[model samples]
Target: MSVAGVGEFGLIDRVTARLTYGSTVLLGPGDDAAVVAAPDARVVATTDVLVEGRHFRRDWSGAHDIGRRAAAANLADVVAMGADPTALLVALCVPTDVATDWVEELADGLGTEAAGVGASVVGGDMSASPTLTIAVTALGDLGGRAPVTRAGARPGDLVALAGRTGYAAAGFTVLSRGFRTPRLLVEAYRRPEVPYPAGPQAAGLGATAMIDVSDGLLADLGHVAKASGVAVDLTRDAFEVPPQMRDAAQALGVDPYAWLLAGGDDHALAATFPPATELPPGWRPIGRVAAGSGVTVDGRPFEGPAGWDHFR
Candidate 1:
């Protein structure tokens, strides 16, 4: 069952066998390249690469989880830009010693997660690598709405968010400390619940600025702050820390606030709205924009290490 036994084409055939395509995908796997419909003539595209050991570990995650995480990371960006995800191009690099079944399951994970967002895995490539790596590019349709970039926050815009945060960091802590009581926190690290629908909805309701919480709250917000030449001040009490994080925090003997403030991979949508605009359903006000640089919590600057520094 090793991929080497089946060869590359055989492995590809096995992987594509279960993939289902939707209306957006004019053509799927098997051609030199796949064709996907761009209904708006403007495609919002984003790519993300996940490497084993760095982004995930086989011992800690299933092949399916890895695939889902990769897809989620890329797809969430498109949604953050106010687009409905349509398709994905996933290129995988795996060691020859890996089993073909594992690769196919990875495909299943990608296909299933993409289908959840009405997207298809139209095409990709395969290669041998020293370690397992997955690179996914997500394509989305803007639906005639202006793409929300990170650079539009005004001084008075209210910072709001949809979906919960800090679960993944708590889950990581649980696994690292060998605690097994809170299955919810642990599962969150293994598989995140990204608020995919929240993205376009926020855009529709006039979000002035937005981003996917790929890197922690303060850290990703820093990008928006720097890009928009503004400061984002978040109140400590504005975020309703989930009970799971509170319970996990008690077990870890550390403030759960760190996880909430600095954890990444939550994939929640953080957006800025007019001070008086009503928040969309599922969106909650968390902070406000100011006229300074960097992010502050309770009006104090964040001094801790920013989330997920890939090189340092």
Candidate 2:
């Protein structure tokens, strides 16, 4: 049934029924305001908005996947700061004509993904809008570890990455072209595989700087480069096209490196560590830090747009 039939409270009931509250939740859904624990005395919070046609399309993704993607967007940022995410407060703005069940599935996706990391959806509000929009705020605890920031990278540091890159961009390219793409490529866009433990683990292992690959690898790294004031020259030879996108790229006549360098939404963790420090498992070296400034592709200047632009 459409949300217009059930009304707001009824729809909220349906969504809340499916949630499984986590340990960090002192009070959960149905409360006027949720009370979540801040065991580390400092809370790490991040928020993101996913707008229809901008961040996602109804034709390309299911409600469940969209919900997961929305939650991941903020949760990944908290994790990148070297924290364990604990709870989420979501705000949903939906068109009256959208099915109520679709919203419920979205909530299920959010709750399920949050639960995976011992977190829960604590509370949220719904509103009517002309289009579908989801805004999620993720809260986390540092567990006494220093929050990793985009700064701290310096000369003589090793650049490393964990999790997949380029796949999401390739997937986006396929979807945008309205052409048939492989299942793996499609799923990469629909459901990103975020390496949950890697962020906190990297911090524990003394990572000097870190950021998630959201706006595109090069563009996002430029943040670290600017923040740390260190020149970052990424080694092109270090990246090997993943098996999932190789054949698809061949068929599409797209360069894999373009996606790796320019694609966003992959959500992989790129970090810098002191030279000679053994990288935490699952992370491999990709580049190095220099005493100079800005970002480089194989030691040369990158001349194009680094990644996706919201206004352009």
Candidate 3:
């Protein structure tokens, strides 16, 4: 049925009524603004928007996948700043003729993703548009810990990552090539599994600075370099490119380097810590902080696109 038939408030009522909230939310749906109890005092907030054609294709991704990806991207941003995601607010603009069932499934995916990060959907809004656009705002708590900002990285610190590197990029390559070999590649593109616990773990590990690898490793690390006024030297030899990616690279006859070094959207955590710091499980050291600006892969300037920018 068309959203016009249900109207705005009616649609919201129908959509939000199914949401299961966590106790942390003081006031949830049906409020001017959501009231959350961040007893931790410091809160982390990040926002992102996904346009249908620009960010994803409905034909290529399911409703659940879209919802999960949208939530994962923002939650990764919150965690990148060294916080625990506590709540999510999603604003959806969909064409009226869009199936209510699809909308419901999308909400289900959003709730599922938030739950994975120990958060929930407290509130959101819905409107009619010509295409699907999802705007997600994520709220996080610092747990009384000082935020590990991007600017805190220092020379002599170790560079480490807490999640898969090039899986999503490989997935995109497979999708473009019309080859159906690796299921992991497609899953990586559809639902990125961010290391939810690693952010807080890195903070506890005395991480000097942290960021999610939303852009390529070199590009995102450059963000840290610029923020911290230091350089990052990534050791490419440290990376063990998965066999699936190698095979996909062979199939496409493209440089796997771009996927590994320049491709973005994996939402993995990249952290800088003192040389003596101990890394948690799933974290891999791939580089080191240095005393200059810019990023080098194996001590050489990385030549590639800067990263994902809203406007190029």
Best by lDDT: 2
What does the lDDT come to for candidate 2? 0.88
Q: If the candidates were sorted by their lDDT against the true structure, best first, what order would they fall in?
A: 2, 1, 3
Residue 276, model 3: lDDT of 97
- Considering summed lDDT, which 10 consecutive residues are worst modelled in model 3? 303-312
Q: What C-alpha lDDT do the candidate models reach, one value each?
A: 0.87, 0.88, 0.86
Candidate 3 local lDDT, 75-164, one digit each (tens) = 999888778899999999999888877887888889899988789999888989998899999999998889999999999999999988
| Model 3 regions lying over 4 Å from their true place | 303-312
57-126: candidate 1 lDDT, tens digit per residue? 8877788888888888988999999999999998899999999988988898899889999999999999
| TM-score for predicted model 3 compared with the true structure | 0.95
TM-score of each: 0.95, 0.96, 0.95
Ordered from best to worst TM-score, the candidate numbers read 2, 1, 3
| Colliding pairs, model 2 | none
TM-score comparison, 1 vs 3, better candidate: 1
Residues 1-312 of candidate 2 have per-residue lDDT tens digits of: 999899999999999999998789999888679999998999999999999999999999999999998888888998899899999999999999999989999999998889888999999999999988999999999999999999999999999998888888888888887964777878888888899799999999999999988987788888999999998999998888887677877777777777777788978989999998898679999999998888898889755442233211
lDDT of 1 at 211: 97
